[model samples]
Target: MAVVGPTGSGKSDLAVALALQLDGEVVNADAMQFYRGMDIGTAKITPAERRGVPHHLLDTLDVTEEASVSDFQREARAAIADIHGRGKRAILVGGSGLYVRAALDVLEFPGTDPDIRRRLEAQLADAGLAPLRTRLEAADPVSAARLGDARRVVRALEVFELTGRPFSSFMPAREYFQPAVQIGLEVDRQLLKDRLARRVHGMVANGLQDEVQRLDAAGLREGKTAARALGYSQFLKVLDGEWDADQATEDTIVATRKFARRQLTWFRADPRITWLDWQDPDLVAKSVGLCR
Candidate 1:
């Protein structure tokens, strides 16, 4: 089973509760939560909050390491297999849409070569996205039309160089890798916005600024993915004296609300997910009912 929802939704707690009843362990699918010191900002589950249920893939990467969906796919599946081998259920949880799809769907990831990627990145840095976008449009118009940033454009080009195939050729066809249940928590828009605002403020109160400071000294800025994390990125400006703590908090709140909407849009598009109201009194019971 997989429990997915927006940032402020109670996916983690529900997953833990489901694990208690379903004899399951959680495999985290949140990309940011993979980092070692990204606890408060990512709202990572603490040891006590997990209620003794084992969680895999959380804190598996240093702040300097980039997260790869392909790598995560292999790790998540392996963890699920191991859990099943132990006669236990696996509750995959998180709001990272691509990571979740990579783990659960029939996705094919072309291999990447550091040399090719480095060369492409260097070209991007030197010439900017215009030249790269033009080149990509000529080779892979589909990807070029949709890829929003230089990083994705470079990735598409890198895939082409490495595999002699367009990056779009590998998009999964929504075929499930295994039989499973996916539960999505639905939140009221205004209520969720307020919740996210409060959550970001709570994160700040809980030392998000200090966490960002510690990770910055630990090479967080060099991390391709970790550096760009929601609250982490915004708070780094605070450390640089570019923004005050209050400004950082407000920015994070806005960014988090936007991210939550994106998450809702992504998960809602999947017809397989059974949606449950976040505030339901019997959310767990209803979720377990759906699983059974």
Candidate 2:
């Protein structure tokens, strides 16, 4: 079973509830949670909060290591197989759309050539993302349309140049890699917006600033992925004296809301997920029913 929703939607709590009830363990699919010393900012569940449920793939990376969807897919599937082999259920949990799909769906990762990648990146640096994006549009219009970031646009172009195939061609269909149930938590737009704002403020109150400071010393700034996490990024500005805490708080709230909307858009497009209200009184019971 997989439990997915936007951040601040209580998917973590629901996963623990279901794990306790169903004799299951959780395999984390949250990209940010993979980094060590990122607890406060990433909202990582404490050991006590887990209620003794074994979690896989959390805190496996240092601040300097990049999180890779391909690597996570292998690790998650291995964890699931190990859990099943022990007569325990494996519950996949997180809001990362790609990581969730990588764990549950039949997705393939293509190889990359460093030479090609560097060449494309240099072209992006010299020419900016527009020309590369235009080239990608002509080569793989689907990828070009969906990918807005320079990194992904470059990757799609590299894939096209290397394999003579559209990057979208590697995307898995809705078909599952194995039989599994996906439960999504749905929240009202306004309520979620408010909840996200409160969550960010709570993180600050819980020492997000200090957490960012600690990780910065541990090389968070050097990490491409970890450094760019919503709250972490903004808080880094606070560390740099570019923005004050209040400004970081407001910026994080806005960025988190935008991220939530993107998560909703991604999960809603998948017909496989069963949506449940985030505030549903019987959320765990209903989620367990789907698993059974």
Candidate 3:
């Protein structure tokens, strides 16, 4: 089953608990959580928090390595099959909407063409997102309608340019997984914003800046996707002297809020999802009922 929520929605905590109770294994869907040495900033589940339950697809890659949504889908699907083979449920979790949808929809990405990649990279560098959105709109207005995300739009355009087909066309046009419940954690907007601010502040207190320093010292650059992770990138500005510490923190909070909104939009589109308010006292029971 799938679990999705905003950054500070305690997805990891709920996932761990559900896995333990259901005799299941957790699969990581959050993009940043896949990278090793990104523990604190990614808010990765600690060994203790895992409560001896198995979790897959987290910390299995180096920070410098690229993790495409396609790669995640393959790995997550394999994990789920293995869990089913072992007679245990696979608790798919985290807030990366694309990864979650990929696994749940059993998506098949088109093969990449190097020539297309080069051209798309050039377009990204020169004309920027506006032209990419225009291109996606022209190729597949349906897919464009489904995505307001600039990043997804660009990626779709890249796929189209390479294959002469809409990226959405690559998705399996029929059901894959037969039946699995989807649960989404939710919070009031003001409450979630407050929680996100506090989480950002906590990350700063927990050496998020020092983590950025370590990553930078280890040769991660602005162009790399890992370096572009929310708090990490903003802290890079602080290190570069482009922003003061306070400004850096403020920027992270604002960006996080925006990211959380996007996550909400993505999760809300799935009719299978059962929303659980964070404040619900019966959350465990409700979540368990979903699984049953």
- Local accuracy by lDDT, each model: 0.93, 0.93, 0.83
Of candidates 3 and 2, the better by lDDT: 2
- Minimum summed lDDT over a 10-residue window in model 2 is located at 191-200
The residue pairs found clashing in candidate 2 are none
Instruction: Give a tens-digit lDDT track for model 3, residues 1-292.
Output: 8778888888888888888788888998999988877877788889999999899998877667777887887888899999989999899998988788888885677777667767777887897777777777889888888888666776787778778888778866435455778899978999999988998889899998898888888765733568878888889899999998789999999999999999999789777789999779888779988888
Q: How close is each model in CA RMSD to the real structure? A: 1.0, 1.2, 2.6
Q: Residue 26 of model 3: what lDDT?
A: 93
- lDDT of candidate 2 over 1-292, digit per residue (tens): 9999898899999999999999999999999999999998888999999999999999999999989999999999999999999999999999999999999998999988899999999999999999999899899989988999999999998899899999999988888999989999988999889888888899999999999999899999999899999899999999998999999999999999999999999999999899999898988888888988
lDDT of 2 at 179: 96
Model 2 TM-score?
0.97
On the 0 to 100 scale, the lDDT of residue 140 in model 2 is: 92
RMSD of 1: 1.0
lDDT of 2: 0.93
